[model samples]
Target: MTPIGEENRGPGLDERITGALVGAAVGDALGGPVEGYSPDQITDRHGGRVHGIVGPWHGDDWRTARPIAPYHKGDGHVTDDTLMTHALVRVYARVRDHLDAYAVADHLVPDLMTNPRWIPELEAEALPLHRVFLAEKWLVARLAYGHVDPREAGVGNIVNCGAAMYMAPVGLVNAADPAGAYAEALDVAGAHQSSYGREAAAVFAAAVAAATAPGATPDSVVTACLSLAKDGTRAAIEKVCEVAGGHGDFES
Candidate 1:
């Protein structure tokens, strides 16, 4: 049994699910401020620390580094990653099943471009679906050939944590089902993220799924994530755990 399996020997199902979603959102928000910063920068700002979601924190310059929409400031507001995760959760609540690439694309891309819920910074970056489709015309062209380039299918917009951060909800919806969450996250993440970026999203999703099981602890959740993540993400998780361990509790 996984560490989560061992921990989840007590809590009710609803409690576990709630814990998983809350954990994901908190993790996303907490990590938002430090996204893409080098370990040195992170250490300098927060004293080589990992923090939980509590109060607002400042993020690095989005314009110079990640290139978010015009309204974006240095404040720690979540990017498209969290927003798209919420969108996926809404869709899953309606359908109560897994989603396909086209289904997620149909909802996320167009919505991000037009939705007022997005902060001004993100809204400004939204591209019309028609433009994205046209730019990736090969996606449609290759539909007949049974092959589509995932990279070409989405608009060439921000490639930061925007897509990955929000993907946690996918794992929550598929709680105790890591494989399913990984597959679904990849399908959606492939459209917007690639390389380490996509891998980070997938690992987060899988961790949420594993953490949703009853009685699961934060430690177990981190362990579960390590099994699936690679490169920077895995290293980040390790750093988070190390920092968490030194602290008395998340509130401290």
Candidate 2:
């Protein structure tokens, strides 16, 4: 890696960054239908593996797993991951630099409400943010309309991967600087997360910053994660990958 720069940088840096962003969107759509299904369940239902775009859940065992409204997901559609990421992207475009929690209330909320954009999976033009999960909607409502403070906006909400999942762009923007990315993600995640979920956002941003660094490789990415992760988080990943190593890649 020649380091991140406009001049005298290594080749393919731009492509890799583009790959990171586009790949996140495409992968989100592909994985949307099977979002909550176990690997075993997916194989059982799809008869080995999913190939092309699939429709909504057809099984009877899935009601409890779906969102309350559950607006016909899958079928080339994306979930909250893409929605939030896109909103954040727009905020970055406006700011043209790093951001913190206040940007969530200022830029993201209006984008979610007024902006009409095409949802790839839904294959329609609407307020793309309308498809966000209820929990996410709550954050926006609290910040934009409920008079909540930006720093305390995430209080009383469920702590989950909702934050960390979409923070890769922060890492991408602050590429090669894991600490800066982690700090920024932590600050911004406060608008929609607390406790472990906020911690996950920091870890994820750090991982992205490290992965997007010039000359980053798969092994180096794992190394970047292990360096920043702590205790059970690191151990759990090691154990899971150990089991995953024996399995062949699915032909999807």
Candidate 3:
């Protein structure tokens, strides 16, 4: 292994970590309303810009869109993405060191269970994940009740982006050690995801850790992601960027 981005000379470690967390939160809130919309749809709506928090989509989009439970998320209401992130942060704060699947079961499961917060998407304050969404509720159930092994828990879960979507904090915590971050995230995410979701989570953590490197720039970050990402994830990103680039909107 090349040790991924495990270099110590990277500058502004604290700033990079903070940026990653805050950026994820802010971006989640901003993108929440537009989550289901396509790029063209987003452009047509919101005047091509989400200047601030807005309500759910309107008009035909609303009629055609998948049913969102108890609409009216209001401005800046966060979804399970941010909620999972905060739970992970609390776990890190308590452990104050590296984590594995057991730590995820002991700390993260409890955090998701007892820590009640306003779930804007669900429009209710309740236990995490499953209570938030039946699909997500599996995370807590498997670890807390089913007593499954954390490392293998994700084996049957849906193959989606749910795991990868909330994995940036692991990358930030591991900082320059992309490999370590990827390993830990893979372990932690196993309780909630499987297949492509698990793969994406590991790659996302690696990318974040890689970006936290000293003197890291935008191009360098993309390079790191391409390097660390494997198989489908790597090829998908390259192809998407290349295709998206043709439209001159890859950055959008």
Candidate 4:
């Protein structure tokens, strides 16, 4: 295998980085409104598969809606996913090096608590902490307030994608280096996730790293993820691929 930064076979580094970042933000915005809806629900609500940006699920009642109230979810608004992605980028900028749990404690937690930015969903500028869900809030609660060890801070939190959602930057930083990305993500996500949640974060980062590699293909990325993934994460991806293998058309 080519060394991480030594490969020069596919898109240039600049292009790959730009594509990954822009793609993540765009995808996040597109998925915001239909985030928790079932496929059939999304299709029904959009009058078909969503082809472009749409309005909040409850339209004018968005502010008073029962479940998603007080936050606008669509019309190009990004959810916490993109907010955390941007925060990871800022952490990368400040550190100028690979990050770990300590970096989360020293940089990311502070940023979420102190930085007030334009929250599209909120349609207002506010601290990221205000918009992030309770899972993310665990970071500040555990690290800044509880003063738990960064590496073990995620122990009692719910196991979910709170860490994985923003891990694209880890993959990008470790571009072309799936193994490195997986290891680094394990360390970084340790501050925010545990069990399969952390495993998913590591695997997703590896998948991104593999995708950014020179001459990478979808199959290659999947192979890299399968190789590094563990427990239910591996089984779930395998099952998805197995089920998908029977269908060639995504729109069917």
Cα lDDT, model 4, residue 245: 93
Which stretches of model 4 miss by more than 4 angstroms? 1-10, 246-252
Ranking by TM-score: 4, 3, 2, 1
Q: Write the per-residue lDDT of candidate 2 for residues 1-252, one digit (tens) a residue.
A: 544674554546577678878888888878888878898999987887887777666643333444523354666777778778878887999999899999888888888888888765445778866777666886777897897998889888888888887898898888888778878998999998887778778878887788778777665666666666565666655666567683222111
Model 2: weakest 10-residue lDDT segment is 243-252
Q: What is the lDDT of residue 86 in candidate 4?
A: 95
TM-score per candidate, chains pooled: 0.57, 0.81, 0.81, 0.92
User: RMSDs, each prediction?
Assistant: 8.6, 6.2, 6.7, 5.1
Candidate 3: misplaced stretches above 4 Å?
1-11, 49-51, 58-66, 120-125, 244-252
lDDT of 3 by residue, 11-125 (tens): 4788788888888888888888788778898888777777787777753244245575454443676777788888888888899998877888888878877777776666667
Q: Please give, for residues 1-252, the per-residue lDDT of candidate 1 as tens digits.
A: 557665647776677767656655566566656666788887777776755432223444444453322324334455434455566777677667776566555554445445546342343534322223232333333332334454444344344554565676778777887777887887777765666667777887887788777656776666677767677777777777777685222221
Pairs in clash, predicted candidate 2: 76-121, 77-121
- The local distance difference test score of each candidate is 0.59, 0.76, 0.76, 0.91
Model 4 poorest ten-residue lDDT run = 243-252
Best by lDDT: 4
In angstroms, the error of model 2 at 135 is 2.2
User: 1 or 2: which has the higher TM-score?
Assistant: 2
